[model samples]
Target: MSTANTSNNTDSAIGAPVSATLPTLSRQDRDDSRPQQYPSPSSPHATSATSPPIPTPSPRNGRAGYQLSLPIPRLQRSEWVNLEGLVECALSSLGKDECTGISELGRGSHNSLYEIRFSDGTSCAASISNSPRQFFSADAKRSEIATMQYIHSSKLYKIPIPKIYSWDLTFDNKVGAPYILRECVKGKNLSEDGRFYRLNARDKQKVVKELAHVQAELSKPSEFTQLGYIYRQEGENGQFYVGKMATVPSGSDEEDKMRESFMGPYDSLTELWEARIERETLCAIGNWSQLPSDASLPSMLPPAKANPQQFGELQQLLSGLTNLFTPPEQLSKLCIHHSDLAIRNVLFDEKTLKITGVIDWEFASVMPLVITGRFPNDLGWEGNEFARSLGKFGNVSDGGVWNHHYYDWTSLSGVQPPPRADMPSPPASPTHSPASIDYLTTPNATANGYLFEHQASVLEDFDNSEGRAPSPPSPPLPPPPTSETSQQDLTSRATNLVELYYYRKFYASKLAARNFNLTRLFIDAVAYIKFNEIVLGGPEKWFASADWIKEVYWRMQEEDESAREDLMEGKGVVKVPEVFLAVRRREVDLGKWENKVMSMR
Candidate 1:
């Protein structure tokens, strides 16, 4: 999913929100691509949940052609062929009033979305997925449903997530795919409705705060189906088990022992997601290129012998062997996920500006644990990426070790693209260069058919406080000293946010690292660096302030050979090379400054 970005820094976290001095959005652009039909299927919210008929909003600006309905016949597939039947069953389970209409919304990389409206006009969302195969296995699908169910069943899970009105599967399909249905969630999808941009800073901050809460709650994994928060403790056995009094329900002693060995603590929702990704990534690596991924990293990890005979047997039935590996010890492993936890997937009220709901579930999964920072530019506007190499290659333990590949925003895209008409404003700006981003395509793997894994500190730090809240609405900010938000009570919230950044940076960096090209880092790191570039330049630069850039620029400029020599020796610094070129382009868009700098060359 490549996105075309705009110079809209409205949500660029380094500073306060302002009337965005944005490049014209594609909404106004003449798209020469194929005639796009934002086909909204007829899966409206179940009639049981409807509040009132929100007659399709009059076309914006009197544009009469945006139809609220697409004639594509619903439930055409033979497997999920009888949605009406499933709907009936769901209606029965949800107390016939739980549904109003099942209108189709759209689809994603893995599932089909349906809107379920109840009779009250209030609605929730529903999804009907094909046989959960490939990236989404049935168990994982069930797990997601279970995760949702966990939310619906808990008290702390008061994040406005859509409730599962009912879930049905025409189970006869290992033959095809399974069917899932949920209720419709109301409010403007900031991704879809442009009105969200009009929100005042107070509302935006409130939205972000609530988002942090939901994320934290979602990350807490409890034994019973609880969503938001889950407190846990070890049971009689030495194994880590989530028990009563404070935690959600746990499995039987046997199940607990078996799962506890690998899953780690189910104390938080993110911990579970993190644990799951580790196991999934662990099991995900299986001869994709068939060149034998594990063959090279033999000395890197523990030896696990897979039966060659067993491998030979499965090779016949499989296409791309993406193994769904089970965890050896339930408590030790975590999942690979978008550590970046922003309100990119949320919607807000047109009047109140309060968040309606959060959406994007694509990067949500059980993945490897070694991933540190995904998106390098997610940290406010300053392009900073961090990672935990997990000592896979060394004898070290834990994942906080740093492999310093310094330099800011030189590798990737500079200004971030504007928020898509279809997605919420992404939390971070990719301040890399224009050439390309150095993101990862494949999971890191090893010689014994193992994939490289790292711990995501995301879920563990999902809590939030005053600092994490959006800055108060004010006139554009005057330069201020750096305020430490390191302890913003962001327990799992920060961790999730970290994972998102980690994913972005990892893929972008790996993109650069792949061909052994350090420029790749520059390519992806550029957007981030550019944000910093603007930060360096201070207010003189529209994309950023001009003061910061001038400072960095002067720091790097060689005043004399002695000064350069001193910088080279790490003594008196002539300049900071970490300031990359891609970032300089942000506020210097006119090139007037660039040409003048070239004259100095």
Candidate 2:
């Protein structure tokens, strides 16, 4: 929909335990013109060739919002939406006389939003997906619509979720691009007001309490029937698929292969996790099976310092983790998580600190508590002691303090959670509230006989380690002596290993994308080992140390570039551009700093 889209960077990888961020609402320059009649739906007309020019927002403003209406410079290849066509389509669909004002609402990596006010003073938001290269897919748009519809139908949460009036998945709908029209939820976004950090402790706590209660409501297990994307099936008799894995078109022949199966709406959380683990394992071993005959590691590798014994130990540990978390019995319970609860997505009134709405449900999914238990990464603040002290500013779910607020609110609001079928009856303790017990403990604790206290400790340690922040906690790597580990040990180790694997995989993917040749590093044993070692340090440490790895890669990159230059010079080829030559010299300097890091290590 044409709702605000936050541009904050957030983790939204499938099956990854990362937080999400959406687009932010940018302040708009008020249009001086009076309200105009809404375009008639019966005889819609797009702006003429000489239609009065739409005023573009000035760039002098510090905040650019999501999409800058200013035409991107010629060399910039970023996708741009056909806003004129979208405006015409939206106005036509609404059947309003003519829009009084249509202004850029926000922009995000994948979509751009515009607010359209009808002559009658009513308005709606329009979200147009960036064509040719969309961050989100057709299935994702469908799932988002389904999520909002489902949430609206349930009336489970007190905060407002915008209602989706209509949507066009493909440009075939005369809009020339995919767009969603929904009710324009009024009230300034928290980011726009820049008032989040200004609230009093009492108000901040109130926001946290409200957030926790909303989380509790969203996480109801009974509401979702299965694990996967939600959508409505085709045909007149098509049924709504709440928990079905969605499939979408892929590859060059998008139309013919439209029926092709994509990944899945996994049957269980274990199945989804295994699919990811298996995919990454392939990047390491290539096509070689784990047969004794193929005992040697692949040869497409560079020499490294990793010991074979340690490599084998880690590999075994990772494998044990895959098997350990594979079974349903050992898995945690599943529930829907917003997945992207960053500040941009949260809407609230600064006066009361009461949240008015939470937007962008596109990434919402049914995931395990292990994935959804922590606060969003974007919400983490390590250096700012003042921000950390406020329950709303720092991680709300930290230390179970937010959980207490959530429980208290649930009790006061009379929002009863459906009984967890898996939880065991606690020893008679009148003091322990069921909500408190439920919030603190996990399904794994109940199923595996792990103590509630132990579950809390592990989850907290885990959030501290893998979660993003200025200086995340060092990975609480399981105590030494990797031999003779138990199931619980494997579980603990597996969680970290999974987190580490994804962490390295994310960077590795980035390197490959930036320097296509670096993809060869995946086969380079030395590179692979160093990459894992980096992530093994946990999020903060790994991120801090990443410059070293990038330096080595870039040095090798510059060397290759220099060799290319020499070949061209020897062949009497054209001289290289001074700009290119200067860039190479700077790269060489960067390599020196990277070398320093290695020397110290």
Candidate 3:
């Protein structure tokens, strides 16, 4: 059918709640001035020469509430849709027709959002999967829709989630794509809103507290018996069930094979970790037969070929560590968690500073609590200058006191000590009066002076027998403030630093207070180690160096001891050692280096 005729038929057939007088574009308008075409970059059917060029929205356009248009590549030809078909399906889903507007909201890594406004002033968002690879497949979409619906229907979870209106898992529908049409959450994304930073410390604390509450709720145990994605049965009121894991595509045919082989509803954490390691290993070493005819080995494998033997050894190491950390009781249950909890995924009212909704559930999955439990990324101030300044002031322990010797008050207060030579000497003793000292200075009196000096030296030699250096003079107290303005500025900065520290502390405390297990799982060092081994190629890339391995192993042992002590004491928070942080920094740098090398190929 013609696009316009299809829209008209949809409006009349559905009896949509849209005005009958809504305008329709003429044939000329439809052909010349309709929204621009966005063809998939990987599609064989590229736009013809007569078609208009693709649109490229500037960065500023995104900030101005316009979509950041970009070419979205599709993994299969069936996942293609025309604008008219998209609008028609969206209208049918909303039970509305003759919509006032259909505008692109934004495009993400795996999907694109479009805002569909109707004549009655109501609006809904349609999220269409742009890539149907291993991660954004039809199964993944089904799981995401089921998850959102389950959360929306359950009264146990007080977290604000957008209501799902309709969803399609097949590409044969009118939309010609797997999609979910849901309520258009009203409010700016928390990360994009500047009002959050300007709030008073109390209000800011409240924000983090609420976020913590939401996270705690999400980490609650589920009825599932395995680790995987949630899927609903094929009925109007179907029951949700655990299904195969949804994973990211590695942009290679080997990734497809690996996913089919390793994706599972695993019975144990060890099984899951092993499957992940195996997948990463094989995908890193791409399938030679599946490579394009013209592609070179370097283009697929990057720096060098991967050693399967090394991957096997790494898997064994991870297996041992996973067993060490995984409690037997936790293996039988799973908890659902948002894949990414950054501020960008959070919507909040600017006036009340309350979270209105949480969006982007395509990657959410049901997994072991240890894997699901994590602090919200927004509360972290890892690379902030203020956080660094606070760290220099002192390391705050779980008890909310500066316990360790990490404090450098002199540096924080910006005070410089006077030179050693300028320090005042003690007054001369009565036995060695000034006049007696003058006589000692005279050349004729050198014999007595030499004998006295030698006698004093004997005592000094006795004092130095232990080979300890003499204690240095103490620094003077800081001088009085130069101005009230400077004092106010210092106070303001100090207050900000304190707030930053406590915001994270408060979040950890909330989780710990509910159940120390949550905190334990959140900071589980074994999980980080596994991530390094599988995702970052830690075993093959860095573990070969004896010094690197030794440092990481030592840090791991220290963390293990500290974790044990904290558990015994029923403490929720464990201060990470500086050595671990240094190691993570190195890992981050290495990841960047690897990316750079890959780009060069």
Candidate 4:
């Protein structure tokens, strides 16, 4: 990483640029593709009389400048941002005399990050939310600061959280935007670190174990009675309290807009669901009427307006399914969850692979343990197509079954198994095949058994010694060991599959050993549904079929019955289709969709 300051401004903040010493850029830094220059603070762009333009860095390479772009016209603003003012605010907060330089660190969906270096050799990260509407609430910045402070002060978890030095929730400050200045966590994001993917199965398991432990610790304090955003109360010694749930902004600048920005600190999960459904219903109806016929709508919005009565029907259906969405009493308690636990949000040491800090708590909120508990996004088998294919054979938690299936195929085909110390011994009965192994006896297995058997048959096709006629699967199998499809490629794929199985198995076991209740909640089907609903918007937006409302109602009924039977029989777990657990796919698809829409804009 380049330590030299990238900012062009000299001693004076928000003043004419002056000549200063510049560091030589490394080859890597010189080749970096992101825009590097910050717009001059003294730019001649006129500011709105009512609200000054939020300063943003402009690209000198003639590319589109980094700015908050939204579908809402009223929320769109100029790309010019007061970078010098932001640096000055950070310096003032840290009690620094002079700034060495400021450089853009990165940009996320909602915030832009910068690293500001001071003359004293100290640096801090500033996360600036370019638009208050990002979170659909004005209190987004304040709530985030409060959440970070509460977690940092509590010291209840082993994971490191950044310390907030200062923050502004409004554009009243010189920064001209809401920003949080905090200690710069001295580590690289786990996702950005290439070394992580190169680790052996055992080492990868260690990382997964640590992440699971962090999640277990976060679930320790689950006594919160209300489901909402945490906020710090007013006064000199104000305490944190669970407050209204943040929702979409009403797009009104009036006083009532603030009130509408949040919905409720619901007493129960049902109430929260009801509030959410109602909000989405209204938003859908409003969008249907307001948007032009030819205008492109975000995926979250309905494609076309339904019968006015259908909206009510959808709301009622969701309202009645609340119980199905609710977990058992033990797992119903609310706990703080980092809803977006992507690898990019996690910081870790490159040498030891120990997690240093977790950032981006803007979306963190109190929610039911069932909904909060799950494997972190990076640990899930969503992005890797091979891993996802393996998932078709069994549940993610059934690592032993996957291992057995892999070994069964490799043994029959006379292929050597990958060198893995963690690989479990094959099934005791050598004759046991994927079709015969009863890893899960639940209805879920029966529902997906055919797919599993089909995959098993395809693997059998690789072996011809039995003289059985080959029945290849739809996705054609690789031709026999060509240069392009060598044994090494097959072995590599098998290794990846085995590693994912072990990683998930280890993660689940770690959660169970640390907190069994959390493990139970982690696998709860209804909880995954609720989590997906939050991420991909309401179920209404999930499909284009007009019968989606009806489909959701029927599916909930079936799940509810299955859950009841499992509990009655002491099984204690509700299993659903793999599609419900495909969170990574939904998230990735949404990102791509959003980016496409943004480009169109």
Query: How accurate locally, in lDDT, is each candidate?
Result: 0.30, 0.39, 0.44, 0.46
For all predicted structures, in order, the TM-scores are 0.37, 0.48, 0.57, 0.60
lDDT of 1 by residue, 1-601 (tens): 0010111211111111111111111222211221101112234342232232434322223111112112223323334434433333433344433333444444322344444343334444445543223222333344444444444555755556545444433344221345554544445433222222345546544454454444334433333332121221222112221221111112234433433443343443334334433432333243123435433322212212222332322222111111111111222123323223343445455467666554433223333222222321222321122211111111211111111122232222222223343653322211221111111111111111111111111112211211111111111111211122222322332343343344434444443333232223333323223332222111111111222333344433425656545533434311233333333323434867885896699
Model 3, 241-351: lDDT tens per residue? Answer: 888865444445654565678778888666766665566556545544354432342221222322343345445555444433444353224677675554545656656
The better-scoring model by lDDT among 2 and 3 is: 3
- Per-candidate Cα RMSD to the true structure, in Å, reads 21.6, 23.3, 23.7, 17.1
lDDT per residue, candidate 4, 393-475, as tens digits?
Answer: 23212211111112212221333432233554221111122211111111001111211111212333432211111111222
Evaluate model 2: give its TM-score.
Answer: 0.48
Model 2 weakest lDDT span, ten residues long: 403-412
Between candidates 2 and 4, name the one with more favorable TM-score. Answer: 4
Residue pairs of candidate 4 with colliding backbone atoms: 55-81, 55-82, 56-80, 56-81
Candidate 2 C-alpha lDDT tens digits along 374-416: 4432233221221122222211112111110111110112112
For lDDT, the strongest prediction is 4
List the candidate 3 regions with Cα displacement exceeding 4 Å. Answer: 1-81, 132-136, 170-173, 193-195, 249-254, 280-316, 328-333, 381-499, 512-601
Candidate 2 — what's its lDDT? 0.39
Cα displacement (Å) at residue 377, model 3? 1.7
- Runs of candidate 1 exceeding 4 Å displacement: 1-81, 95-100, 117-124, 131-136, 156-158, 169-177, 193-203, 215-340, 359-601
lDDT of 3: 0.44
Model 3 residue pairs with clashes: none
Q: What is the alpha-carbon lDDT for the whole of candidate 4?
A: 0.46
Look at candidate 2 and tell me the lDDT of residue 148: 71
Model 2 regions lying over 4 Å from their true place: 1-80, 131-136, 155-159, 192-194, 234-238, 242-262, 283-315, 323-331, 383-601
